[model samples]
Target: MGNEETPESRERTDRTGWRGLLVDVTPLRTSPSFAKLWTGTSVAQIGAQITIVAVGLHVYDLTGSTLAVAFVALWALGPMILAGFVGGALADMFDRRTVALVTATVAWLSIGTMTLIAFLNVTQTWPYYVLAAINAASATILGATRGAILPRLLPTQLLPAAAALSGITMGLAITVGPAVAGVLVATVGFPWTYLLDAVLFAGAFLGILSLPPMTPEGGSASPGFSSVVESMRFLRNAPNVRATFIFDLIAMIFGTPRVVFPAAGALILGGGPVTVGVLTASFAAGALLSSLVSGPLGRVRRQGRAVTLAIAVFGLFTALFGVVLLVTGMMVGSAGPEGVNVPAVVLAGIALAGTGAADNVSAVFRTTILQAAAPDDVRGRMQGLFYVVVAGGPRIGDLLAGAVATAIALWAPALIGGLIIVALMLVLLRIARGFQHYDAFMPTP
Candidate 1:
C-alpha cells in the first residue's frame, strides 16, 4: 500500500511561505487524541487563570495589603514543589493517563470547595490559602503528567511545533482568564467568578477521560523516594537540560513581578482590577502573538542560543516595565482608580507585552530541549522537575517581590530582578558554552 498522508509527511513537503510563518496545526490535525487533550487543557487553564487573578483581587480587597496578596503564591510553594517531584515519579511508574485523571479530579474538587467558601462569604483568609495550596499541588501533578504524554502523541520533528502550540494554549488562557476575572469580580462578585472556574474545569475531565493508558516506555522504576532521587541524579548528568532549568529559575524568580500588580493598580497606575487585568492580558497577548509567528522557530538549529537570546530580551523588557512603573509611581502617589494615567499604563502594557513574547519564545525552546533530550522512562520525572521550576519559581518571585516592595518601593523588585537576570544569564553563557552551542539535529542532555 502507498504511504498515507501524515503530519511528518506534510512537514517534509512544506518549508516556505505563510504556512511556515504560522503555528503548525499539523499536531492537532494528526492526532485526534492530542486535539481533545489540547482543547480540554486550553479551557481548563483559562478557568484556572481566572481563579488565580480573582483570588489575588479578593485578598487585596479584604486586607488592602500587597504582601497578603503575594501570600497566595507563597502558601502554595512548598506543597507545589513536593507535588512536582512526587507527581513526576507517579507519572513514570503508573499509567500517565491515570495520574493525570486523578490530579485533575483533585484540582476540580478544590475549585469546587473554593467556590463554596466564597459563596458563604468567608472572610477568613486561611481557608482560601489552604484550598489554593491544594489546587496548586494538584495542578502541578496534572501538568507534569501532561508534559510527559506529549512525545507519545507525535513524532520528534513535531515537538517544537507542539511546544509552540502549547504556548498559544497558555497565552490564550492567561489573556482571557485575567481579563474575564477582573470584569466578573467587579460585576458578579468573587463567588460567581470562582464558580465559573469550577464549571469550566470540567473540560479537563473530558480530555483526561478520553486519553488511553500511557505507561512509560522501556519500563520505569517503582514509585517512591528512590524514583525521585533517580530523576535528580539524571538531571545532574544532563548539562543542557540543567542549563534550561537554571535559566528558567533565574527568569521566573527574579523577573516575575506579578505580586506587585495589585498595589501598582491601587497606588501607582490606578484603574484598580481593570488595570491589573490589562497588565496581565498584555503579557499573554505578546505570548499569543509570538506563538502565531512561531513558524520559523521549528527551523532554527541553534535552539540553546535561541533560548538565551529570548531570555535576555525578556530581561530587557522586564527592566523597561519597571522603569514605566517607577515613572508612573512618581507621577501619582497613592492614586485611586479615578486617577489612572493612560499614557503610563499603555507604556507599561507595551513593555509587559514584550516580556511575554520573549518569555514565550524562551519557553518554546526550553520545553523542546527537555522533551526531546530526555529518555521516555525518565521524561515524566524531568517534566516534574521542569514544572517545579516553571510553577515554583513564580511563587518564590512572589515572596521576593512582596518582601522587596514592602522594604523599598513598588518598582524596586522588577527593576532589581531584571538587572540580575541579565547579568546572571551573561555569566551562564560563558560557563555553559557547551549548552550555548547545542544543536537541535543532535540533542544532548
Candidate 2:
C-alpha cells in the first residue's frame, strides 16, 4: 500500500496474533473529541477512585463500624439521584459541554474542600460526609451528561466499542486507584492522598472545557419539571429500556458487596489497607480483563440475552466469592493485626475479579442497547435514568450489604444477595420477553 494506513491495516498491526481480542480503540483513533474526552476522563477516574477509597478509609478510622461507612454513601444517594435527573434536563436544555463542565467544576471544588479538611486533620465526621455527598452528587450529574455526550461524538456502529473502551478506562482506574490510595494513605497519610486527588482533577476540567458545544438540533426545550416528566413518559412507553434499569438495579442492590470490603480487611482478611486495596483492585482487574478482550461484543445482536446471561454470571460469581470467604474463614480462622492469610485473599480476589468481568460484560451490552435505542432528542434524560440506575443502585446495595453483614456475618449478605439477584433476574428475563429477545442490529425501545 501507499504511505497511508487503512482500518484493516491498523487492525492487522495492532493485533498481530492473539492480542487482537483486547478492547478496540477505533473510536479513540477516529474521533479526536472522543479521544480527548476519554484520555482526560480516564486520568480523572483514577484520581476520583483515590479520593473515594481515601474517604472510606478515613470514615472507617473515625467510626469503626462498617454500617457507618455504608451510611456515608447512603447519605449521598438521594441528592445524587436528584442531581442525575436535573443534570439530564440541563444536558437536554443547554450546551452539553457547559453542563458537563459545570458539574466537573463542582466535583473538583468538593475534592479541594476535602483536601483542606484532611490537611487540617478534622476529627469531625459530619462535615466530611457532607463534602462526600456533594462530591458524589456532582459526579452523578457529570456521569449522566457525559454519557449523553458520547453518542453525539461517535458513530452508531462504534457504540459497542466505545462502551468497551470505557470499561477499560474504568477498569484501569479502579485497579490503580484503590491500590494507590491504600499505599499512599498508609504511607503518606490522608491529607496527601486527598491533595493528590485534587491535583489530578485538573485533567477532567481540561477535558470538558476542550469539548465542542453539543446542543440538539431545532433548539431543545428549557430545563424544568416538565422535562423530567417528559422523560418519565417516554420510559413508560419503552419496556426494554425499563427492563435494563430494573435488571441493573436488581443486580446492584442484591449482589453488591463493596460496603464490607474494609471490614473484611480489618476483621477477616487481615492485610489491612493493603488487603482493602487489593480486593478493590481485584474487582477492577476482572472488569479490565473482560473489556480487554471484548472484540466479539460488537457483533452480538441478541444484546438482551447477553445482558441477562452476563448478569447471571455476575451473581453466580458473587455468591462464589462469599463462599470463598466462608470456606477460608472456617478452615484457617481470621488473622490478627500482625497476621496474614494469603490463600484466602487470593481466592477472594479471584472471585471478585470474576464478579467485575461479568458485570462489565453486562454493562457493555446494556450501554450499547441504551445508546442505540434512545432517540437523540431525549438522550440526556435517558442517560440520566441510566446514571440513577448506575450510581444509585450501588448505594442501595451498600445499605443492604452493610445491614445484612451486621445482622448475620460479613459474608452472608453477598451470598444471600447474589442468590436473590440470580433468581430475580431469571424471573424477570422469563416474563419480560421484550427485554429477553432484544436484537441489537434491529433495535427497538
Candidate 3:
C-alpha cells in the first residue's frame, strides 16, 4: 500500500472528521438543576399529551362531531395568541423561573378542576371548553417563560443540540402519551385519565423548583399594553427575526394536517380510535427517530439553510400524505355519509411520520437561530413572538384544514395545503439568500 491510505482507513477518517456532530450532552447531563427541569418537564409533557387525547375523546364521545373536538382549539386560540405576546413581556419583566412556576401551578389546577368536573359527570360542553381554554392559556405562558430560560442553562454552541433534545422530549411525550391515554380512557375512564394528568403535572414543579432565580436578561420593560405594541415595533425593524417568524408561520399554517386525522381514521382507514392513536404517534415516532439519529445536525454551519430545506421536505411529505389519501379514496370509491373502506390509514400515518421528522429538524434549527441571534434584553419579546408563531400557526392550520375538509373532500385540503407550502417556501428561500447562507460560527441578528 506504500504511503497511500487504505479505503477502510479513509472511511474511518471521514467518519471522525465531523466531530461536531457528537454533541457533548454533558452540560445537560451534569447540571443537576437542568437535569431536574428536564426530567420534570418530560413527565409533565407526557401528562399534558394524555390530557389532550382524553379531552378529544371525551368531546367526541359526547357529541360525536369532529368539529366539536376541533373547536376546542378554536376556542383556545384567541386567548393563547394574546397570552403568547403578553407572556413574553412577562418573562422579560419578571423572574422567568417564578413566572413559569406560577403558570404551571395554575395549569395543573385547571386540569385538577377538569378531572373533578368529569368525575361528577358534569357533561356540559361549556365547562369543557372553558377549562380547556384556561389550561391552554396557562400553558402558553409557561412555554414562553421556559423557552427564554433555556439559553441561560447552556452554552450558545450547544443550543441546537438542546433544541434537538427538546424535540426528542416532545416526540416521546406525544408518541407514548396519546397511546397511553387511549388505553386509559378505554379502561380506567376519562376521569381517571384527567386525574393522572393532574398528578403528573405536579412533576413540572420539580423542574421549576430546581432552577436558581433567573431574572430578566435586560432591564425590565414596563409590563403593559404598550409593551406588547413596542415589542411588535421592535420586531418590524428586525428583518431577520421577522423572516424567521414569517417562514415558520407559512410552514405551519399550510403544512399542518392534523385536523383531518379523525375523519381519516374513521373513514379512509378501518381502525377507528386505535388508528387515530397510531397516526398521531407515527408523527412523533418520526420526530423521535430524527432526533436520535441527528448526530450530523450539530456539525451544520448554515443553520438557516438547514431549516429551509427541512421545512421544504416537510411540505413534500405532507403532499405525499394527501396523495396517499387520494389514492386510497380512488381505490375504495366514495361511501357517502357512511365512510370509505380503504387501507389509507397506515399509509397516511407513514407520511405523517416523515412530516414530523422533517419538522423536528426545522424546529431544532429555528429555535437555535432565535436563541443565538436575539439580544438578551429583547430575547423575551422575540421568544414571545416565537411562541405566537409556534402556537398560533397550528391553530390557524386546524381551522383551515377543518374548513377545507368540510367544504371539499377530506383529502383535498391536505393535497392543496401541502402544495401551497412547497410553493411559498421555495419563493421565500429564493428571496432570503442571507438566510440560506447564514453561518452559525458568526451569529447575526
Q: What's each prediction's clash count?
A: 0, 1, 0
Cα lDDT tens digits for candidate 2, 229-288: 888898899888777888888889998898788778877778887888788878889999
Candidate 1: regions farther than 4 A off: 1-9, 56-70, 116-126, 186-191, 262-274, 326-339, 402-412
Report how far residue 310 has shifted in candidate 1, in Å.
Answer: 0.5
**lDDT tens digits by residue: candidate 1, 1-445:** 0114465536633768887788877778777788899999999999999999999998988899988987998898889899989998999999999999989999999999999989999998988889999999999999999999988887666778889999999988877888799899999999999999999999898988888889999897675689988888888999998989988988998998988888888888888878887898889899999999998888888889889889988998989989988887776655444678888889989999999999999999999889888888999999999988877778778889989989998899888888888888788778878889988778888
- Among all candidates shown, the one with the greatest lDDT: 1
Greater lDDT among 2 and 3 belongs to 2
Q: 188, model 1: CA deviation in Å? A: 4.2
Candidate that beats the other on TM-score, 1 or 2, i.e. the better one: 1
TM-score of each: 0.88, 0.87, 0.88
Better of 1 and 2 by lDDT: 1
lDDT for predicted candidate 3 compared with the true structure: 0.81
Q: Local error of candidate 2 at 409, Å?
A: 4.3
Error of 3 at 69 (Å): 3.4
What TM value does model 2 have? 0.87
